[model samples]
Target: MTDEGELIAGRYRLLSRIGRGGMGVVWHARDERLDREVAVKELLLDTGDSAQAAEQAMRRATREGRVAARLRHPHAIMVHDVVEHAGKPCLIMEFLPSKSLATVLAERGPLPAGEVARIGEQVASALAAAHAEGIVHRDVKPGNVLLADDGTAKIADFGISRAVGEATVTGAGLIAGTPAYLSPEVAAGGEASPASDVFSLGATLYAAVEGAPPFGDDENPIALLRRVASGELVAPRRAGPLTDVLLRLLAGEAGERPTMVRAREALTAVSEGRPVELPPPRRPTLLSPAPRVRRRTVVVGIGTAALLIAGVLIGVLISSPGEPSAEGDQPPVIGSTSERPDSGCVARYAVTNSWPGGYQGEVIVRNDGEERLTGWVVRWKLPAGHTVDEVWNGSLSRAGSTVTVRSADWNSVVRVGDSVSFGFLGAVEAGEGAVPELVCLPD
Candidate 1:
């Protein structure tokens, strides 16, 4: 309600209203005492809420500003002070002549991969720095990203951010971030982690390259929230080179999302004109095609009538599971025993479920090699006491005591130091046996 030229806290004079968002309005203002330009953000308070709740909300906002002040990154906006104006808290921050990423996208549509990556590198680095100090910018979206004239991309608006242990300002069941950018976990009422921020950044960059959020732009907030909570991401067609990294950051599993540090490195690689080596898409099935399949079979063409039947039957049996081969589906072939020392892939299996009659298992295969891996087949004995009943993510076959699980089309390639996970459900004789050892074969 304050008019232009009005002074707040007896120091800063309001010049004009520059921006308004759901939570607050930003003003082009002047620091009368320091004789400098500044931006003042007026925090909106709920008059209907009890006086106690309102007071708590004001303190929380001031505390968030103080936390943001601790950060001094080139890509992070600087928070100067917190003061009272119109009987409410107004946070004073640095004023920059720039446009929000949202406005830019509205005017220019999607950005180029290189430009998006450059912007992402700066913003991701800023996030990593803030995370290092135990702060989270709960709200990270195009609207909060500022593109300065000097080409600096800065992350603004920590109004809803809370220190790791602090309570949320949105109260129970209320999310603090834009629904379009919220991670699935947060949409499902899960706590926000560094990974959460990475998810948001992924969504933000996704919008940068695709011209809209991964989830469709539905006018209904609840519908959009449902889409985010569903964790079904629309792939980026125009992202081009940025497609891989953006998907990695938007992985459905929080643990699967790339770390901000790793994200920053990948983005930097793109910005520097180097190739970005990202791990597989968050959901492997969506992007990767199934590995090329090979099935070797034979049939007897001619022989004595009875002999022909026996020979043809042999072929069928030989090609079937539980038959032994000279080197039946062996581990990746090693040229020499000495070459084994150079193998860097590792596989681990865990029994996630079990019953007296059967159990379920999951295996993760990882590449620790210095170079990227192409395709792999993992071998493990089904254990003398167990029999595989069903499998997912792979083609499974048994030859005598050994079981081979070939990578599905999608998981054939493994990123350096990253991994692929697959699983199976199988029967157990006495429900007791030591797990089997796993060996990965290169394609």
Candidate 2:
């Protein structure tokens, strides 16, 4: 029987159980050979199954070790070694004095927007690096995010993370992630992708700020799965500037969501209270400085090219002049300011997402002028009868027909050639959703 003070692998002495999850039990232990503290995870296996099944489980555990050991990031827990003890695989990892985000939320309730964004930024950075290595963190949740004693946040438990094309360790037809944070596609029997990880990250951050999961914390797992599979996520109430980032991350279609890298940038921008500018496209060679839009333009576009390279086709259209598309697949680019060589700043507006009676809009304020701005306000007239419902990443005010968005305190300064952005959801009448022009003033 396994008990405290028992020695494993002839060098590690088991102390006490520090954590328990679906996969295994994590014990705080001492590495007698190295004279250091470490975490030992005793992998649980089904022994009653056939010998072949047992062997496959063992192989899977070994493969997990190999896969996790390849990742080396400051925010990711390090896997030191893997060994077999009592006919099961045990993972030895770096031990840190920390509390899981799950425990923190349970004890502190909802976290502040800035604090949650900081946490999300760090965790997303690790996940982004992991994805670049072709590893997918299939189970990303609050329980897997660790808050270290030195105020650093690290992502733990990559045991369930799968490399591309690997067979699932779980039994046939079984899902691998927590229902509350599972992406809609995964909840509906689809494969987990980096996009799914973005969804799970969004759900984790959503829970951190809203005091509950996006789909609510239902008691029954099956019922929760049903709700998640339906893909109707509840809107966040307390997100404030964090709301738009969460919305983009929690997009229903996996392809609609941003990449983990872009998610990390967005979270970082929000945490700093600046306009959110997505990182530039990866393949600069495939894009033209001025490309004409048609019925279907197939070229390298922001947020679209990376997903294409990953084998997922996304319909992010940039419409030509005039009315928005009736399909409403992607909000059309309404208008932009004329570019001047040394202009201080310029504003461009696009309808990001739209529906029957509402739409989401984004404004990119780019610094093109010689002087840096300590503060800024962008103003434009909303179409007659249209009203702004909410805004994120900036403060909103109105004077009759004119709508003004001022930079937030944390994001007020504009550097040369850099950009900041804000998004808003608005109520609008059909055919009257277009804005005439935007004027930017730097303070």
Candidate 3:
């Protein structure tokens, strides 16, 4: 390995080494052509009898670079280029001045609940996007997550990531991901799925909250694999809803595990202060609560007596035909006719409100269901005869028959039973009713 200030590929000037792993070294470098700093990963080529191994490593590096380059997401690190330097492969990625989650934990112990949730949600979203594109992260330990200076979570290190349907590259039959975060299926030599990512994410969250991986101490990869495969690890307590979520993700059977989308929803709910009900624990048969008996006879007697008394009262108080009815006994049922304008149509964070200028509407958002809302997207039509003229607190985008406002990234995650206020201005036409419909998307 070379020291800082060494030039690679004749153009990328190495500033300093940022990270090192089993496969290669990651360096902070300045790309002369782009006039910006970037991270360059360089693999060490093998010699002697391991020449075949070197060839395989080069191929894997090339493939990873290609795959990562194709994934474009706000939370994914961007791959710029891949090249060969000194007979070894190198990949250039977006340079970010951020600390790894592992570093943060080491420095500050556990993080606050809100901050952990925020980070977890971002990582989950990124995973969802990647999984939708047929990519499996394969490795999702805390070290792979980058906490950018701007507070954005950037997922990195796709060195071992594989696309769905791709042939397995870990031909040695050895496990791929860090043992602490390995999904049971992966530990047992099965193919990784979106679920595997979810499992690893759960392990990562466990570490974030409990300050240690759930598997604890058995650093030998094989031993860790056995423990994961057996599903014998205890969950972190007092971790709130996170504990439930991690347990589901770490289920021994892949089929029993929750989907990444579902996991995200659960985490979002926790972040938003919504209650996440875990399945009731099984109890001893002898200790079960006894059922209550029904009181049918007493109920029937009360109903019969009330009906007979009402019949006699009606016969005595009946008025003659055409006689005036007492206003006190019979009052007209009139429906309310007052039309009140809605004034709650404004967008919160992560949502954009595109109502026309001068248009106003009301939005009543409730954590109606038990689940928490990590984020939401609302689209509504301007009331007939009224056109939206202005909006606030969110960005707005409009198309024919609909105006969509997305919540701001910061406010996208909302808690259960919590409500947000948003309003917009629209030109009011005579007799035009403006009602806005809101759709909440859970994290």
Best by lDDT: 2
Backbone clash pairs for candidate 2 read: 275-421, 343-369, 344-369
Q: Candidate 3 clash total?
A: 34
Clashes of each: 3, 3, 34
Per-model TM-score on C-alpha atoms:
0.62, 0.60, 0.57
Worst 10-residue lDDT window, candidate 1: 309-318
| Stretches of model 2 off by over 4 angstroms after superposition | 159-177, 278-443
- Which lDDT value does model 1 have at 77? 87
Q: Lowest lDDT 10-mer window, candidate 2?
A: 304-313
The alpha-carbon lDDT assigned to residue 388 of candidate 3 equals: 53
State the C-alpha lDDT per candidate: 0.68, 0.70, 0.58
Over the stretch 182-208, how does candidate 1's per-residue lDDT look in tens digits? 776565433467888999999999888
Residue-wise C-alpha lDDT for candidate 2, range 407-431, written one tens digit per residue: 8765578898776666566776645
TM-score of 1: 0.62
